[model samples]
Target: MSEDIDSRRDDSGATAPAPRVAVEPTPQAPAGQAQPGPEAATPGAATQPPFNAGNPYAAQTQTVAHTVVKTKTKKLPVFLCSLAGMVVGAVLVVALIMTGALNVNRDAGTATATSEPSGGSQTIKIDAEDTTLAEAVSAKALPSVVSITAWSSGSSENVMQGDDSEASGSIGSGVVLDTDGNILTNNHVVEGATDITVSLNGESYEAELVGADTSSDLAVIKLKDVDAKNLTPIEVGDSDDLSVGEWVMAIGSPFGNEQSVSTGIVSSLYRSTALPTTSGTYIYANMIQTDAAINPGNSGGALVNDNGELVGINSIIESYSGSSSGVGFAIPSNYAVKIAKQIIGGKTPEHAYLGVRLGTVTASNARQNNLSVNEGAYVGEVIAGSPADEAGIKKGDVVTKVNDEQISSADSLIIALRSYDVGDTVTLTVQRGKNEKKIDVKLGSDADAQTSQGEETNTDSAEGAGNGMSEEEFLEYLRELMGNGGNNRQ
Candidate 1:
């Protein structure tokens, strides 16, 4: 068991029950045309897929073909970097586990909810054959789907990169957004390409970068010489309206097969993960989780809903083996569209920044720190000029909620902030001592996501720079930073 440390005193010299955040920094749908051909087959693998009608994420003894990883993975912070590497190396340890069964009792109804957590329900009821859903969605979506081949001059990642090395090509996917040929895909797809092309309906056209935001892992590119009148802009759906268990589809070039389609259901919502960049990290917030078989080449493909509307950009998958283990992630369409529009307007996308180092409040830390709650993000150190600092967030402040959304972890805080545009002010509910306080903060702006990671890439800014920092070492570093960080103000 973890050590007990919840008996700490508050600044007011009174006992409290604040929660401590535990840092486990770890890491789509689509629709389109005709009924997908019979399930994809792998040689020397199972002759039949364990995934049949109604089974979205369960398979026993089934193995996928292994391939070399070509995409860039984020560099991890010191403390859990090795742990994270181990986690990534071991993919799909935990399933999203939804419990809101929609009357689909398997053997008859298919998926059944095993149990529910104290809060929130799970899973959607499947109504039709997976093939029928895949076929209808594929037919409706394939027309707008485009195969992207990006040429870069740098070293290659299986997915994408903006390399200036010897010119080479990488394959990804995208969706047509308008008659203007403005297409939406992950930024990594066309990031550093000297030349990019988009193929639709078997005709290829040259494309140019409109704008790309690495922060959200999204980008917008425009096709050259394509008639806007002939474009079939895809229908954009509301991700906020999505629920667990809803059927979804993914269409892309997985392993370079164009228009390859897979069917699954929404696994969970508002998921968070950080990708290592040389500068620091790219944090993906409010993401959609599915088991739609997103593979390396599907980086910028479409995650569409049953209505054949775009819901997310199929992006990363959680697997230790570097292959699709049926646990995949997507950039929520709302954020994708929000950033895409900003890029289209010729401005870099901006995310709301709090400028504070945070720690997760767990039961032990809550008792140790005398906190009132057993879950929340504990404010360790606030940046001097940051919005949170200006708003009076101080060291030791436990933030329990952001604009009424209960913050259960540090990742939750990041997820809440990602939903807002920079310059938008919001309320923060903080548990200070014996009383709760609501502070309205005007969020500040940070540059759109960048291509590199930074010095503070570890679990929290409070831990200082470098890799492999233990908790005791992190506390010592935090003290040193506080001593030199100036600003003794509460």
Candidate 2:
């Protein structure tokens, strides 16, 4: 419960909801491509991975994977980190109950309410007799997946002097969004990068950063020196149509290996977790969980269905040895596209904000606190003049639902809020003592909340550092700060 307040206050830069998932801490390669060294450490910092003295941009090692784990009985410690050259950590807890039916039903509602892409029209129906399903999908989707390399210059003056040694870079993957040369990848992949290069079909071109949103861990980069006509855009799909046990393919670079493909099944859906970083806590809600072998350098890669249609963005993985433990997560295409569009439109990506401290409702806590509900989001503190306070939501209120969606725990509440955008109106069902009441509150923007509260919006300005720490040092620090155990692959 104390951890809940520490994690959830990020809505106002005070505290925010923490994430769960236990793997190991490992740095993400630029495109899931293999670097010229042994496996790097996971970003959760459970254990330190061997550092390659030759490669300064090696992945950091740590314990737990990058996703936060929440159970009805307890909330596990979240060690979610970025998988890029910077330490990316997420935890994998097998204790999670696979909620397939719940995800399908929830996503069904999203499909009707949101104008997401229906890739059914573009889904390629291949005759299994003619070729294997993987072969067909790979042939169609291979052109749409590209390898990305993000370079960070040590000094502006040194970069101008053509000092390549002073520059550090990481590898990750990207999905071609359009023929206009727009590509979508994880923000962590490109964060702190001054130079970016994209490799497509064995050709390389320079790219420019369009924009980034740290809260959602999504970013858009545009090719600056490439011909749009030569680009092949990937067919987008409706992620709300996904079901548990469905076949999916992960295409990306792992350990600098470009255009690699791995097969797996959708293990779970609607997985909500957060990665607390020096910049801020990244909320990964309503995610697609799969058993695909997502490894370091697979960040920003493509997670497609058998039809070669893009369904999600490969982002994080869970492992204890800084390798794949058959637990990986992706951002659903619907939400990823929504955030990407906002960045492309030159708008700062915003997350819905409900200014209130949260604690998970559990049997022990409920009994100790004399609460009626055993499962729900218990309000600990409400920020003054914030949405929750403005709506007359009092402390100790147990939020059970958001509109038709049931809020089973504090994490669920965070996940539900993510389904909505800033300025959207939502009806929150609360349990006060034995009385139940519904409160309508217009959601506010986290960006606005930060501004009003005079919080730092710049990611580089975090951790009392005016200039952000280098990716290499950041990973080392993450391993130490988070803990020294488990080695995550991504």
Candidate 3:
């Protein structure tokens, strides 16, 4: 019995205790309050909860909460870091600009506006005032400028010397003044020219002499078979308006150099100089002075204004070395137009002859001749039966003025008379024996008077009515009266 009891006890001890019924404690709202479905266990206490089928989503709620906490912890740092980086970059850029490391010109905006391209605007901004002047002048004046070439055969003397007998050629310039191919040039350019040719726009044609005034050093030529289409007439400007220091331009063939251009200002005005024409006559008086670089071949070229109008014609240059010395003289376009009009109208330009030989009235001449007027043209001799004699002008009359214009010297009177025609009437202010007298006289043609005088003298001498002198002696007497007595008989 004791052994069986002990075996049972051992079996009982080996067997697990009776399964304890697990009862979930109610959830406590507070520390001693009645609990709900389940109760919370105290710290370090173990509790068993019965399987109550309630709160099915409780486990899922806990998992979602835990996941949200982990996401916040990781993403917070990355957002803060990106924000900080952007702020730092912006600060650095501002600092660089503030420091003097960057250069920005304030005037860049204005310059950029000016650099824009012009769209078909006719107006252009020239660099200088004179540049604008040259542009305006060249545009209108270049068409009227013509190039001239003259050729003449060598003389018989040159042919017999075993040299080339070919004709020598020279080049100059001219200005087209009319639509009918009437051109104006210096007399020296066409003088002794046998074959004269005028060129314009690469075409050349033979020319004919219309008339030449040696006293004014002006000549007019006409081109055959040329019309208004080939000719560009120049606009005549007033030279009387030209002031000292006014800008001017010259176009010519300098040194036989074609289409050369030069520019300068008016150095002086109304300058008088002596020029000898190819006809052996001396042209004395009024010229427009400029520094426009006129050379030998530049003679007869046009001096243009800023508006490209013809102001003057390049006539002569005062130089010693046969080159430009910055002293150039031009015949005023005013006078040129007058001469041109006569030649173009088929009227021969006849200068008004005074029939009196005069000299410069210096202080010495005035005292020697007992003249009251100090500055006047002293009358040396007066031709009989001439205009002066017909007007009661005597040998002792001192001319102080012509019409209303004052006469500075004998050259001034000659220059003034060249501006008139043969039948023109002139009013002379003569100072005779301290009394000024005004006389109006009608001029006569010198050509007709000379021819008549030659015929009459020849007839008188041939009939032995005068001094019984030979033809040579009568010719010598006539030559002496014409103020050229020193040359031997030809």
Candidate 4:
């Protein structure tokens, strides 16, 4: 025997089976034993056990005697007990069937049962809840989306000469603006196009460019010879009230696939970016960022909320592969509509401009220059007779905040100014030497700045002043101002 086991006993412990007991009802109690009366057998009586007094499965009450007898019988096997239980269940099921107690309805292999509530029974229509959020929104918005085809000059000659490869045409998307045949789209989409065609609801209509704002990358076009009843303008939502993580849908012609729909949530808000265009570096500010699949032809399409209201215009996508990488940006509807309204009224679109040459501050540079703050935009020069100069903002002043928003760099300050309209007054928090002060300055117009100073105004236009700088030169200038070394955001 091993030490781990108890080996005190000389032999293995084996015993015979215990005696069995049989219970039998007695006609009378034994001598000197008390007898149970009829009241003792009654349900809920004080003398009865509470659990068994009213139990339906309880056996009848009786005075019983137990007798022990020695036997050589073995315990029943599990198989025998299981078989007996199955037999009892089958018998009970048959009894229920005979008494009409259980009924199961099966139709087309689907089993359904009617249930009654405490008040009454009712009928339910499961199909009534089948409509989904995406389905409903798409139904309401698809009519407002239109596919655009732009034809550049000399395309008619190319077609007449049987030279399809030389035809100058581009595909894009647009949103219907009104019943009078006005459509909203990106300026880059229809830029320099001699002929513009709009395809809506299986019909094509000729369109003419109404106005184009290169700074904001927005344009308006009007359809010719189109019926007013055929147009459906989309409902616009308040982009200022939009919150991050809210559901949004992108309706556009991705890859020229008309009426393509994609869904995503708002990834961020109030984002700023710049894109290199033929005219200049187009500045996008206070943009709504989403993860929706915005592709090449999705520009100027609708970015709508779950309520089927247009919140943004799908404009730009940040991806290295030139395809959607789950990062896209849109122009807020409030600002886009403002520009559209200006264009419709035959007025040029205006952007807020600050007359200052700015540079970003760094820790080492701040220490070298003995500046009080290590972050914020460093004012290199303030234009004379400009808003900053009028407000006593001098050179060497670091702008720390614009209104309530913190300005961490030169690019941020420019982006912040782009959100406001011209002539709007804003409070700027400046760090001059060791003292901080607030100054109120009214913004000026970019259009006025360009016309008044011609090519001499080096003031900040937010997009590098449209001074005919090549793409490489503009990017290099942005690098120095933003302090991002050489990695241009565009």
Candidate 5:
């Protein structure tokens, strides 16, 4: 009833709901009006405008329109694609199952697939026989291998030093060389032994030293009053036949353990090292190197090849631990035989006394020194009253040959001289000025031979000439790696 009545609606006179209007498509267009085509009513096409109720005639001109969408054409392409994809998936699934689960390559006799390791190399197992060549060699050589016990009044300091007390003894191994109970072992093994006991095949016999050479580190001892009916010496093998990779076995008493055997390959050949034996310092040349575990007690033991032949004598080891560091040196059987033979013949082996300062005669030296031959030991100085001087050998006289052996270097002369006894006469082919002459000179004793070195010896030695050791305890040991017979190797 107030001033706000004019802005309000009248509810008493409210009209009924307007009738809903419906629109329809026109059947035809007037001459001047344009008409829609069939595409105008298609899905997602132009839509209709709002219906008009004020003009009934306008409503009558509208007609309802309907359009049908064809879905079969689109669905036909999808069905074909699905069928092709299912066939390809089945083929891939079958191939994967064959390789992963079936292990199909085994049935096809296929080669194994190889793959490189991530970081390091891959190894394959190789089949090898259970038996070794060392077994046969040891069996054949063990019978000839003997255990030696040395008793001395001096302090008990020797290789293979036994359980015997300081005032008692030492122990080592030796090889039997002959049927007469002669054994061959290192000179140091019985070096200072006042008494020696040789045990062979469980029978022990008293031994006497026959001959010992300190220079060569070798000695021969004899088993006194023992039965030699079944005794067989070791078989000697050629050391020259030893190749660097050939198999070798060591038969000896290591740490007083008798009949202990170790096997290895020849690591090297022709090694020269100065060793301290029972006698003195000796230069061992043309030696065999092996890793066959040569220990302190193994000294004077046998170093045999695969055929059980004695190729070397285990003497010294080059080590800092005072044990086998797998680097052991052995005396070549050839040199050992040569030394043993001289000592066994009741003659002391001495270096031949060629009293002259010698030099190697090269082609240059031959031309410069007016030498007749290009190779030989050249005489630089002739000591007065020596074998060379007494034999009319003068300075500048080149020694072309000694006896039947050629003298190429100074060492060859010494080696050739060592092969013979001191009193043995050797023929020397000498070149004086321009003429070649032969002179026979008797080799002198050790005392006289000391001055025979290439350089002038300052002092005269007064020692007597002998095989360095007494033959009373001299026994030779030799074994055949083949049949076990003669014991002498040198």
Candidate 6:
């Protein structure tokens, strides 16, 4: 074999190829026979000994990775469920806010705010003149106004016996005219009174009667045990300056409530009504008419002008019964102040009287009678020996004016005459048969007229048949006859 290999490598030191030797074939083992060799004994061979049989690290590592992957994959659904729960919770919260289910109370808070609002804008601004006038009047007048209560016996007789009669209390208003506690009120308030009390700012005090004038329905009372400190006197205003539809304010006790205030305009001026008094005498006079709410307790209250000055005293309400009928009457402050001064001075003031039964000359009556003076007071009758009779005033004359003041109607004449007193000379202008004549006549007292009528009963009765006396005149004649101590009438 070596020689042959050397011959093959002859030209370039090449070794000869090995000779093909005829080798015997190896014994063919069965397909399942175990092989015996170093090849068979390798680690991965089936016949090899197991070197790492006790340890299964490789397989265990693969098993552990697969388990970790499966466990991670299983957690996705849990995470998704948790996220859906959070979304549901957020949606519920949003729905709750969308619906209104809250409660709030406002009136409970307002009840606690007791102080009035002072900083708001005013609806109307008071002018300097108006403010000055109000300040000047209100500063003094508020303290002068007082509330009065008079308790009277209900029994017509035995009123002085306080124990036998039922007590009925009346509420009214008053004005303090001076610093000496002299207060002015209506006569009707103190009439038949067993007890009288005055109140100011919620304080009560006893009042003593100064005097009373039944004809004018006025009375004066003095407060006891009180000094007039800080008392404001009401400013006196001229009623003559008052015009119809002027703004006015009424301050008084209305419906037994004190310090009640009402405002209205003067509806009419120079009004007249015959109010019946407790003494069975008629108070025939002039008054101012207003639409202000004047209840039963508002009598004697002050009717103030827009300047807050005293213009009139609330006297009566034109009602069917004892309630207000939207027509309130007030006595002019001119007359009230005059009567108050007289009462304070201890002088009994007498009312001026013109002894004549007068009626308004209506348009129809003026046209039918062809009267010389139209729209004037038609003198129906004149008392004998009276002012008109003494001044040569005839029964057929019509009064057109008194003392240069034109009498638009009978009411105007009456209002004008109220300003004068007894013994005052008044010039009367009368028209008779197209002749206007002025007659100067002295006024007499109302008492004088009553005395004169009392003395003329039989003469009036004898002339009643020839005078075309109506039923009302015949009744008046009979009343006068009875009052004059005539034996036939009673």
Instruction: Compute the lDDT for candidate 1.
Output: 0.67
Write down the RMSD of candidate 3 (Cα, Å). Answer: 42.4
lDDT for each residue of candidate 5 in 1-490, tens digit (9 for 90 to 100): 0000010000112122233558987667778754677655554454556667788567444345678887656788798999999999989879887779644333212111111111111122222244345655665678777888777775334424654445555567887776777778887678777888877878878889998876667888989997766466777778989999999999887767778899999999876533222233354666899989887677788999877778898877744335576887788887786667777777765554556655556677578866678876666676677776788887777777887778765434544566666578889898877798999988776644432321443323211121121111111100111112211112
How well is each residue in 86-199 modelled by candidate 3, as lDDT tens digits?
999989877877996644432212100010011111223333424455665665566678888776676333544766458665677898876777889987777777878888
lDDT of 2: 0.71
| Estimated TM-score for each candidate | 0.58, 0.62, 0.58, 0.65, 0.51, 0.54
- Give the per-residue Cα lDDT of candidate 2 at 7: 16
What total of clashing residue pairs does each candidate reach? 68, 90, 7, 0, 38, 4
Query: What are the per-residue Cα lDDT tens digits for candidate 1 across 1-490?
Result: 0001011100001122333548875432245533445784543564645455576565645556667879766655654788987887555433222333332332312222111111111233444544465666676677767888887664334334554356666678897877778888876677677788788877889899988776566889999998755566777788899999999998887767787889999999977754433322345777898988877678788899987778998877654334476778888888788788888887757778777777777787778878888888778777777788889888878889988788876655765787787789899999888779999998876652221223335443322110112344334333432242211101
Count steric clashes of candidate 6.
4
Top lDDT model: 4
C-alpha lDDT (0 to 100) for residue 309 of candidate 2 = 80
Top candidate, metric TM-score: 4
Better of 2 and 6 by lDDT: 2
- Name the runs in model 4 displaced over 4 angstroms: 1-130, 156-167, 361-375, 433-436, 450-474, 477-490
Q: What is the lDDT of every predicted structure here?
A: 0.67, 0.71, 0.64, 0.73, 0.64, 0.63
TM-score of 4: 0.65
- Candidate 4 CA-lDDT value: 0.73
